[model samples]
Target: MTAFRLEQALGHTFRDRDLLQLALTHRSFTSPHNERLEFLGDAILNAVIAHCLFERFPRLPEGDLSRLRANLVRQDSLHQLALALSLGDFLRLGEGEQKSGGQQRPSILADALEALFGALWLDAGFDVAGRVIVRVYAGVLDRLTSGQGIKDAKTRLQEYLQGARLALPQYSLAGTEGEAHAQQFRVACVIESLHLRTEGRGGSRRAAEQMAAERALESLESAHDFSRQPRS
Candidate 1:
C-alpha cells in the first residue's frame, strides 16, 4: 500500500532503491535517518513556496507573502501533506517509536515529508524535486488565497482591543499537558477591563497563545458588542 502511494506521490521510481529507503527512515529507527535530507529539503521547500507566492500574488508585499508561506509550510500543513501521500504508513520507525506512535506525531511526519522531498531531489535532481513540490503543494498554495488574514495573533489581538478601546489583551500560560518532549500548552488571553478570558491549546506556547487569540476573535466577532462578546 505504501509502495503504491509513494510511487504516485513521487511520480518517479527510484533506480537507486536505497535513496527511497533512506527517505522513509525515521531517526528513531536508524542512526543516519533522514535529518540531513530534511535539512536540505526544508531550504528547497521554503524557496519553492516563496517563489510560488511571489508569482501568484505580485501585489502582495513581502510581509504578507512571508505570512502566507509560514501558514502553508507550518507543521500542521506538512502533516496534512504526509497524510495525502499516506507517508505515515511508509515510515521506518524504531521499535520504541513505533510502540509510542511516531507515525502520528506532527513533527516526525512533517520532517519525514521534507526528508522525502530531499530524497527525491537527490535521486532525480532539481527538476524532479520541483515537480514533486509543486504537485504536493498546489492545494495548500491555493488555500492561502482564501485562508486567514496575514496578521499574526498578537497583532490581530492588539488591533481588536485598540479598536474597541478595551484594555489590551494579555497572554499567560494556563498549564502544560503531555510529556516534556511532546508538551502541549494551554494559553489564556485575558482582557483586564472586561474580565474576559479565552483559552486555547496547542503544541507550543506561541501556538497556544495564537489559538486563544483566534478563539477570542471568533467569539468577539460573533457578538455585536465588543466588550460583552468574545474578543476577536
Candidate 2:
C-alpha cells in the first residue's frame, strides 16, 4: 500500500507529506527516521488509551484499568493494528533490512504505527490525532467494556499459580515452521510444581505462548474441580 492509500485509511491527510514519509522510514533506511516520532506517538497512544479506558470503565479499579491499557497498547496489539492498515507495505527499509524481513517484525511494525500517530499530531494537532486514534481503536475499545480485558490468559495463569505459592509458569519455543513472513511458532508452557505442560502454535512466539498459557490455565482449572469432587 502506498502512503496516499494509508492516509486515506487513516482518515487524515498529511499537511506535510515528509512527516508521514519519515514516520514510515526505518533507521536502517536513513538517518532521519521514525524514532523521534515513535517516542512522541507512544506517549500519545498511552494517554489516549488511558483516557478511553477511564471513561469506559468508571467503576473499575486503577489496577484493572492499567492492565487493560497495557494490553491495548502492547506491541502485539499495535502490530495487529499495523497489519490491519497494511502499514508494512509503506515502510522504507534499507536493502539489508528488506532482505532480512524487517518489515514483518513486530517491534518495527509497532514503532512505525506509533510514528504515524506522532506525525499526525505534528501535522495537525492533538484533537485531530486523538480522533484518528479513537477511530482506529473503536472496535477494540468497544469490546473491552466488560473489564474482561483486564486479564489475559498469561496473567490469569500467573496469578493462579502465584496465589498457591507455586513457581511461575515458564514458556519456551518448541519449534518453528513455514516461511519467514508467515512462520508458525510452537511454544511450550511448563509449570514445574504441578508437573503441567501445554503447547500451542501461532504466527508469533508471543501469540503461541499466550495460547499455551491459556491451555495450561484450563487444565489447572479442571484439576482444581476434580480435587474438590467427592470420593469417586
Candidate No. with top TM-score: 2
User: For candidate 1, lDDT tens digit of each residue in 1-232?
Assistant: 3566687766888777787888789878877788998998998888888888888888888878888888778886686577667787999999877755566566888999898888888888877887889899775555355335445556767877787777889899999766677676789999878667899766668767776886676667566544352434
**Each candidate: what lDDT?**
0.76, 0.83
Put down candidate 2 lDDT per residue, 1-232, tens digits, no spaces: 5688898889999999899999999999999999999999999999999998888778999988888889999987787678668788999999877765566667788999999999999999999999999999875675465557745568767777776778899999999876686576889999998899999766688877876886786687677852232331
Q: Which ten residues in a row have the lowest lDDT in candidate 2?
A: 223-232
Point to the candidate with the largest lDDT: 2
Model 1: ten consecutive residues of lowest lDDT: 223-232
TM, every model: 0.64, 0.68
Runs of candidate 2 exceeding 4 Å displacement = 150-203, 206-232
Question: How many pairs of residues in model 1 come into backbone collision?
Answer: 3
